[model samples]
Target chain A: MSAESYENEYGNAKNALELKNITKRFGDLVAVSNISLEIKEGEIFSFLGPSGCGKTTLLRCIAGLEDADEGQVLIGGEVVNQIPPYKRNCSIVFQQHALFPHMSVFDNIAFGLVEHKVPKAEIKMRVNDLVDMVNLNGMESRWPHQLSGGQQQRVALARSLVLRPAILLLDEPLAALDRKLRKEMQTELKRIQKEVGTTFMNVTHDQKEALSLSDRIAVIKDGKIIQLGTPEEIYESPRTTFVADFMGASNIFSGKADVNGDNNILFRGDIGLEILLPNNDKLEAKEIKGISIHPEVIGIALEESEIKALDSWHTVFKGRITEAFYQGDFSELTVKLNESDIELAIHLGRGIAHDKEIVSGQDVMVHWKWEHNNILYS
Target chain B: METIKNATSPQSDLVVKNKKKFNVEVPLYMGPISFLLVGFVFAPLLIILFFSFLKTGLYGEIVYEFTMGNIKEILTGGSGIVFLNSFYLAVQTTILCLLLGYPLAYYIARYGGKWKVLLISMIVVPSWVAYLIRLYAFKTITGTNGIINNFLMDWGLISEPLTMLYTPGVVMVGLVYTWLPFMVLPLHAAMEGMEPSLLEAATDLGAHPVRRFFRITLPLSRGGAIAGSILVFIPTMGDWLVPALLGGSKVMMVGNLVAQKFTIAGNIPSGSSLAIMLAATLILILYLAIKWGGKEAMEKLV
Candidate 1:
């Protein structure tokens, strides 16, 4: 795919190593669309998206493997659009552990040094030091096939890091590994990044992996960053429907919003509920447009008769339990509101389930605090 | 009864053993086929070895006069130079094939068009013509007044016919041309099988394009090199027709020597001895090549 959206915000700050209005196109397809991001020094930044979402393409563009057709790439405050990958002080670890099978582990790690005309003594010392860092001692004389899969990955890591590049780019480096090994490598990768003190830009589809390992995550959908935030912000305050779903599989309900008293939004239709949302300071009092409720905010009721009073300002829904699916500690219930076709998804902890143990087709009430929902504009 | 005891005992072990016994069909057929192959292919070599130790009597029958002198003479006599010449020619053919054929193979493997079968056919279909005929064709192509010389002369590019044919240089060119596709095909396969990510990783690690090739591509393609060299070298060493036809009866190689001894020299015992020595030397070269290649070569990694 291609990145072709960011083609004009062209500033070449060295701190940025920026992608200025960069766009990539492969004929009729757009892989990346108008992505502008500045990777700061010593930050473990991640480009996270689903498979085929063009995270890899963006990484390749930065590595200079694939050139940006519409914009410039600035490295060290100079535009490196014409520079080849080798001239850039960047190293990439591919998903597959692509060790040179003919060489010993030592030679494979020392390869960049040899290419750079490094002294033999320095090459030996550095390779040995990296081997130790990767915890692959005594494997210098071994061929690639002789080692296990994990060893091969470490060798690949050592091979890239031995060059001591300004930034390290990893293209799904854990993709080839088994589940347990992938987790281990992820931790090892983070540890190595910490030790090296180099900026790392990683591309991965594993959202959990990015959340856990990265200092800041750029959650991408169709190659555009849906949200750029820390792990806590991405999880707790997703800005878009895709980010909300992708980060943790949250249920999204779309509805129109009307402002009521004191920054509260009257969210009508499909449960006919109302929610109070944080008021946007820029918009005038009457300008807010849409409201959303996360699944966790909706709770199940035993019966419609349990409420002491009905308040229109704080909304509630009379619904029937259409479906309940137990997922260990929480049960996800699909509640059909009245005679409407709309389904309200409610997540219930085991401690706070419905009072009367409602089965499918049984009448129930769904309610939440109006302030617990979110207000959206545009 | 004994039948009752058998019926009560476990039957699963019998079934397992029966299945194991049923797996022998492959070795059963391979056993006899391997024997036939060995008998037909190796028996002649054994006969040659046996004859080399015996004398050909005046009546044209082998009189078993046991001798090691024949082996000594073949290994150390005037014929030794002929063996060296053959070795030199083969080495040159192998090197020339690598230099020209490698790039061709790499290009076709990486940038080959959709009509690969048709393209490779262009190289291979020419081989269907007789080897002897091809040698004669080359002989004509490089002759003093051949098509090339005539074209150059008619185009006013040269004043006179150049000495283009019937030399060692011409023979070298002919040998390389005939075996070039052999080198190209295997090397191409090796290159096509290679993972492009490896090259990318090399460059990402500060290796320039040329450095990447030497460090990653060359070493990875070593298996192809070995296979290609053997494909060209083995036949070129033994091929006497091409050299004799192209070099204009020049005393070209040990292959010519082997031909002379076997056909015209009237020395059957010496010819047999030299043939055995040639086969032995080939086996020795093969052994050394394998021993040096090591276990990393199990997957050719082309």
Candidate 2:
């Protein structure tokens, strides 16, 4: 739901929430360096990273939980530096499903409403509506502990959303759930964001979670946002070695840019092979060492004569398969061209690979759509 | 029965199967813990249960006859005042402990740095010292010429030493001091178990600091609060030492009443009955805590 909204096509509104040179330090450890980003109104922006990457810390700074040593936070284009969270029109759902254990589900959702001094019948109506939105109905009277982990998360969501805040912040809200439940919640959260039209900022370490839920994901690493892009951009065209590698495990080959040219950059390595990088003129690698292709993008053994077929001129090649393995429905083949190790995983019918008797150490032609190849720098 | 089992369904079946696989092989936290629990936890309780009902003589010897008369007399008169007082003191102690210990726990949990281990040790190690020694130290501090008054006098802040010790107020002070660490430890345990993101979530949710404390911190650490109170409340109810040393004779708590009945009045049966009543009241409080926790609270976390 979110991915489709602020896709690369729609780079999100200029700014609803903006962080300026924010930095957080805990004694000796710097949690977030001087980094900044702009989140659009009603945008489902996500801070994506591994655990301890300061995504949650950054979110906390936005929430006013942790003071940023160096930064400015603007909400709705207003400088909110002096404002406390309660006055900032934001609500947050925590990773542990921080539903008030003492209150019933109904009361838990109604709590913020009560704090804000909303009217009795209106609070009831809003709470019930939220509970229904989260697919929690009759369970309102139950205590937090009585609900399943998933149910507790829903209540947490309900509790935060019922307050009608300008922004809803979620800190790994689905981290506690099992895989099935997490996916279900990701969709539910997306639907809720769309329905409420409230900008949702989520912090998550899970790549899939961020990709599935975020309209735009800011990839944070070592206290800084290294890349901010849509899931498709992040997946199809990762900008750095870390971005390329961290997105998923892939076969990486580093080389020197022997020839730099427009639309095609020729690369050479100790492997005795020269490869052409199409549409990549700049690579920060002193030795064209930054170009890469995803494993899924590499096609299996096919016809060498087919290389002459009309297509992007720079994509077809011949190599020898050195290793192969059946990864679920698809078969992955490791091919070697000169000294460079290239892994080509092809999506195939489960039985076809063995039926065709594709073997390792066999000479195979490698082919890919030009767009699947990405040239990484630094 | 088949229908009932069927109604329980796949999830319950999995639970039962796991339960049989694990719980059947060993009782919950078995081996030394099991043996020691039966030895220390139940054996003394069984003995006390037996003696509370046993008839007693003027000489404080058991008459070996079951009677409710002793239990009745203790519940009836001025004795009820002590009952009310014990309850009032326990509630006060619980509240004060929560107030003092919660911030201490929160500070330790969130902000306590190199001093955290030290602070935690300070909270816990004092508990390891003999209970009598701690109470005696409390006595020395809160006495007529206690440390506080003496310090005030030496500083010429007061003309004479004030009478601060040996009153209901003194008893409460002692109880709060004694149980503050109890509340801190469990609160630390609860707050420690909490993800820091939970508080961050509240803050991000636009909850003010005070609102976050009430809405998030207080509710989440309730387990620790309940555990701390039970730890402090159960023992403090029957405590003779604090009241005797700090509260003096006029303070006359239920514990002092029990002491008075057995030692001074020479009424063994009445003391036994009062002891039994104390046990009943503790049980009721525990029941209320469990009920307050609600059905969700009963889930035994594995």
> For residue A177, what is the lDDT in candidate 1?
88
Tell me the tens digit of each residue's lDDT in model 1 across A250-320: 55555566665575445553344444454544345444444446687776667555554545434577888
**Largest DockQ belongs to which candidate?**
1
TM-score of each predicted structure versus truth = 0.84, 0.76
Q: Tens-digit lDDT track for model 2 on B249-291?
A: 7687788887887799876667767877887888998888768
- Candidate 2 residue A126 C-alpha distance from true site, Å: 2.7
User: What is candidate 1's lDDT per residue for B159-270, written digit by digit as tens?
Assistant: 8998878888888888898888888888888888898888888887778887777878788888888888888988887878777888867646767776787778666777
- Candidate lDDT scores, in order, read 0.77, 0.78
- Tell me, by TM-score, which candidate is best: 1
